[model samples]
Target chain A: MSDRGHLKKTAHLAEVPAALEAGPRGAKPRRLVSTRTIVVYGTLFVAAAYYLLPLYVMIVTSLKGMPEIRVGNIFSPPLEITFEPWVKAWSSACTGLNCDGLSRGFWNSVMITVPSTIISIAVASINGYALSNWRFKGADIFFTILIVGAFIPYQVMLYPLVIVLREIGLYGSLAGLVIVHTIFGMPILTLLFRNYFASLPEELFKAARVDGAGFWGIFLKIMVPMSLPIFVVAMILQVTGIWNDFLFGVVFTRPEYYPMTVQLNNIVNSVQGVKEYNVNMAATILTGAFPLLVYFVSGRLFVRGIAAGAVKG
Target chain B: MTGQVTGRATVRAHPGRPSRLTRNLSAKIASIPMMLTAVVVFLGGTLWTVLYSFTSSKLLPRLKFVGLDQYERLWAAPRWLVSIENLAIYGVFSLIFSMVIGFMLAALMDQKIRFENTFRTIFLYPFALSFIVTGLVWQWLLNPEHGIQSVVRAMGWTGFDFNPLYDSSIVIYGILIAALWQGTGLVMCLMLAGLRGIDEDIWKASRVDGIPMWKTYLFVVIPMMRPVFVTTLVIIASGIVRVYDLVVAQTSGGPGIASEVPAKYVYDYMFQAQNLGQGFAASTMMLITVAIIIVPWAYLEFSGGRKRV
Candidate 1:
């Protein structure tokens, strides 16, 4: 009886923080169904159908053979499901000179995305850590500028960045594109990490500091372990963001290094093709697969990341 | 022996110590990249582009001063005017529709429905897709021969005309539909977050006062969610101005450039036509448009907050 009582006390103690975290909107009142319930469910169902329609069409169209697509209804389930389109999309789909398929672009995206995500997150995380923990004169001003700069459209900075890349002899290369991604991604990732680090327990930081840990030492040992969730959130934001990016990829890289989105666009919308609708839909699905996978796997984190971005902005 | 000598040297140097600028040397070093991006890329680049807009350079940027000549030519171009008109139409419709639809969906989600996560997941998955993917999927879906038009015709409507991609007058609306589909989910998420941020007590109080749910959402809830609405508005507005990739994939600004946007105009002129001056001018105009939107909002947000504080 005493052990159970002690366990209950500790559990209640833990829940206090969770309850405070939920603020005044903690509990949702239970209620019975009424007209309002029906109305809400009906509206949500319709909206869900609207949102899911495209994905459904894409899948069904991708599965059907060409003749089936040409004759039958798009809303219908595939009469004859085929994997040939997926195989073709992954291997033999043409985008101008290249018929090696989206594989090349996929590889290019991986090459670009991996390094870019890492570098951007590393730089932004450290910068965020510094800004949040180590306040110096003129830091806030620069932080403000960085935040405001995010609102500036890419067109304003495109040519200038091109010039900078050219001067550094990295223009038209994957390296240049990686640098571009880092620069553009700095604002959001920094904001994310900054807010996260700021929210961490100051006592922990002080405890580590008083134990003779320096800046890098404290960060590497204490802060990094404590903030793994934030790191995951940052990774999700960057992976999906840099993967889905079209502007920077188109701007900073040459044709050989074009990312998946670019190649998909070219293949699907190339003016001189016979317009293979199945292959195009398959290609579209393929291009979206990575981010969609991330979204599905880390669903709530995706929401939290975007919500943090939106709220803070 | 070397460590002892170094320690003695450091102890001797500590009498004077370092300047304030060098106090947090590691932090200052870590922040260089962000500082350079903010100052050089954003501020310096903006100023450079704006300055170059007044020149008459072509093929490559030059310093030949031409005092608003490029802007004059930009205004004279019928394509730019059409782009502006299309943007206006797309912007207004998208802003209205996304907000209304997004808010309605959020309000619905706030009703404590079952399968809330499933519904939200379905709605927001598209937002994960790139604009290119969104554009291509919609393009195929809206294709007259194989898409909704054919399906509707086969449904015995026989005379249904639903091809917006081909019609210049309503082409932008087609893109608007795709934009709303791709974007409203994010807006809904933002709105839902805002809705959740509201205190549950407010709802109870409104219930006690005998207010309808819709009325509570409107007269009570929305007014309280001003910040969220403003943030959503800014996000949607900024996204509207950069509606390039969708147009590129969907229509390629084609059917005689009916759906061309400012960003596309800048890219084509700069890279394809080799007219740097015109591209710079058009880009400057884009910056001005953003400033026009942002300046007043920033004033209201920052200045108003100061008074409250």
Candidate 2:
């Protein structure tokens, strides 16, 4: 009895620190601001500046002409700022036979991203719901396998996927890339939805079942409405990952359906030519515009989604 | 009474056990399409790759058994060795630096400062950009003649030489820094979420007790975020292993294979070098190495009987 009492006390002691660090249980205290706060904020300001420096340099360089770039005070305002580089990068930066720049790959990326995101998210939601709510033999085994698949590096899978796609006559097509993204996106998306669903009141699902709602009906009525936040989060992650992808896009897609990332790569990563700084910076900014816009607009919601997923997972 | 009525109704509706069994069987049958997708796409694809790594193939993937010859050649290749070394250096520095910077940023952001969203968006915006574009931007920004070097020279402080991208000895470090720029924001976001989820009451109690902020964070807050740290570490590890695009975009393993990474080496052999057999062998070795490192960690995670993101 004494030993058990001691163990309980030790556990209680552990809980105390946890509660203390989480801040006083209730009510905001009167301001007793410390110098440490200033120090912390100051450090953050400096770090933010460092993080923003590369972007500043990219923007400034992109605005400069070749002559100004050559003269190169990258931090200073360009002696003659020009949007000519942006125009050239948009329409005339050479990759191969066509000099029509990254604009060509824009629609190709869109066509790939939209359908892939929807299908993957839908499939993942179904898988998550079934795994969490339905009791079936070998369910845990399937979930384990899916989770393990996430750890396998894409490099290991690339050769085989290429062969399989080739065998099916779908290699180097936009459809092939879509399938690849969907397969890769499954583990993370499934994990997200599964955890989210598990956190929801189990009684809600039980009550739905009592109402004679079948599997699809219960999922659509109860789970889908509650899952809006997570769905948006999944979409954000997929759009960013799919749009920014270069290796899979380059290797999987034929030259005709190459995404903007490939064009951006060709423009800036030119090996044998006179390196064009202005064009490279402009191309990069142009290519990155979409995802950056998404993040900028939905910044708060994105953070909240991440926080919710983190806490629940 | 209601339970009896439902039980009788269920019995009356189903009537025969054989028909009930068939109904259950049909439901199972209806689920086959979903199961088939999971199996064919994930398991089948993985198995096919493992099988191909054993074959002697090139360019358009010819399948003929060639024992361990390709693996032998891969182990002996100088460029492949260089690629392995570069990746090791890049992975360690990038992971450490990004984690440190990200954690620091998150701790600061949790202090409830002004313009929190602006700061967050600024830090995280890079993660939204494709590394292909970011890598190019870095390449241009780091160029010897036209970038930081020229800018410094023109400022009349001609001794500022920051041309690691062109230098054989220091080029990989340049790539690592660029990768860190793109990666740190993701770490910050993940860690910030961890920080925020930390109950607010702890801050107040610590303050009331006069436990200094740094000490409180170090001893109390950081320990509570173990799961978040694990998730971030795994994600970063995967990123490190598959780090091909940025290198290709930024340096092309340039200045005589200075910044070559293992993925790029495998890619070159598979496509440009037209030695698919050796490429597969290199990939097999990488898979083995990654598995050796990851399997134990994965086992521990799963063995805890919890699903981890």
Candidate 3:
């Protein structure tokens, strides 16, 4: 199928002499319950158990009454399952002075993620198109800086960004967090889109140009229509990323605007009050639920998104 | 008259040619956001932080040059020392364990196994959750009374004292457990992709040569996956330096400052302690750490790019 035919054919011809000289050798067919098979399956089973342990513990613990959790070990199944912890975690869990629970944080995250994902994706898609197709002089310099900047710890830029946001009167607002997300998301998303757009047939872009289409015309009509899968990949990356963020949400926003992860941390780790492990586990699951849903639903594409990031990174 | 003027202009021009500024006008306009982000946030913000790290700013940032006073204090602080030591331990272990364990998991999965998808999904699901969640779950699991210790004790292993979160010496390991759980799945995925990229002929060739599977993976496959290894190392290293939220949620650097991390150091000094200079100095150190890893990788990538071209 490829240009390797000649090489393979030559190898086979050379192997013919070796086979004639030494005769044929064969590997013993592996039995279904061979030692190797047992080892592989056994190790995998143990790993799966280890990996699944915390989730199992979290679920059963969340369902059990406080008395049972106190008396029994974490791994045991709930003797009597109840949804009270989930209810209380959703509705009345106190995070500091606020008792409204993770729902508020959930809504805030939705507000933050929806806009941030859209705006970041919009800005980055255009950036990628320009880099891949428009080919302006010195564009690579900025792109290089952006990629390098991605590796820098957020602490270096946090205070400076706070200053900029304060000067613009958006420091404590949701919009400020949105802008921060967009800025941070730019590097990876741009790289993702750039690689993708670069891989598209070059003739398609040339034909669009030949038809007298301008930059926006080609992007909106041609690139956008053809890049639905990539856009979805971008969304998957952004949605999960923005949803899971805690640092920026804490550093940039007031408590009222804290994202779910930050709020979940606050609710669980608040120093006052009796520690409710059941409610805490419920809240933790609630906070993680959105990203897990996306990861599950977007299974292969989710893997593809991260794989694209890894291969390029 | 307008038509006559246009005609004269058209006749004078050999062909339609736009100046550089206007040639890609729409593209340039669209790139304004990218330019602003790069120039203002990435470049400008980094420069600003490094510059201000020199001053003895507190509560409010000021231009009173302190001449490394902040770094002097930063180095002298026991808490900072603890943070650095924890980070070193965490970084080394995180790097080694992640590579070894992640590769092993990936290799096992690559064995033409059934239920591969199910195993992969289970391993990676933790990665979907935030570090905060991972920390909390592990914290609950490691609780001295009601968690692993209790369960082990109940199983007649009463001498089991496995409370890493409570002990000052092993608190960082507690955080490491959560971080590895949250991250190894990603490393596995990357390694899996790398494994998939190897040519099928390589495997057949190894088999024909009667090489053991482990030997093939070790001697042949690994050498071919050098680029992926380097990339993964860079990623894991950078992430190691930024380990903050997990520590915060798990132990909050508690039982004293046993689990203090550099990122947490920066945040606490800046926001809580109101010591801007200390925070700036600490953050600058973090930047230096990242640069140490990223610069050489960039050089390699640049060279690799040339070779590919």
Candidates by TM-score, descending order:
3, 1, 2
What tens digits encode model 3's per-residue C-alpha lDDT throughout A1-313?
3545765565455445445545556323345338788999899999999999999999999999899898988998999999999999999999878899889999999999999999999999999999999877778989988988888889999999999999999998999999999999999999999999999999999897677666777898999999999999999988988898889999999988999999899999998989999999999889988999999999999998877654322
Best by DockQ: 3
Q: Which one is best on lDDT?
A: 3
After superposition, the stretches of candidate 1 with alpha carbons farther than 4 Å from their true spots are A1-32, A311-313, B1-13
Interface RMSD for each predicted structure: 5.9, 6.2, 4.4
lDDT of 1 by residue, A1-313 (tens): 6954774565445445545666767654233346668778887888889899999999989998999888888889998889899999989999887899999999999999999999999999998998999777898888998888888888888998999999999999999999999998899899998988999989998897677566788788988899999999989988998999888899899999999999999899887867778888898899999999999999999998877655322
TM-score of 2: 0.86
DockQ of each: 0.48, 0.39, 0.54
DockQ preference between candidates 2 and 3, better one: 3
lDDT of 3 by residue, B11-114 (tens): 44635654556555666778999999998999999999999999999999999998999999999999999999999999999999999999999999987678
Give the residue spans of candidate 2 off by over 4 A.
A1-38, A271-274, A304-313, B1-34, B60-63, B197-212, B304-309
Worst 10 residues of 3 chain B by lDDT: B1-10
Which 10-residue span in candidate 3 chain A carries the lowest summed lDDT? A24-33
Q: B132-191, model 1: which lDDT tens digit per residue?
A: 999999998899988899999998999999999999989999999999999999999999
Query: Candidate 2 on A182-298: residue-level lDDT in tens?
Result: 777777777888888888999998897688666677778999998898889888877877888877887788888998888778767665577777888888888888988887877
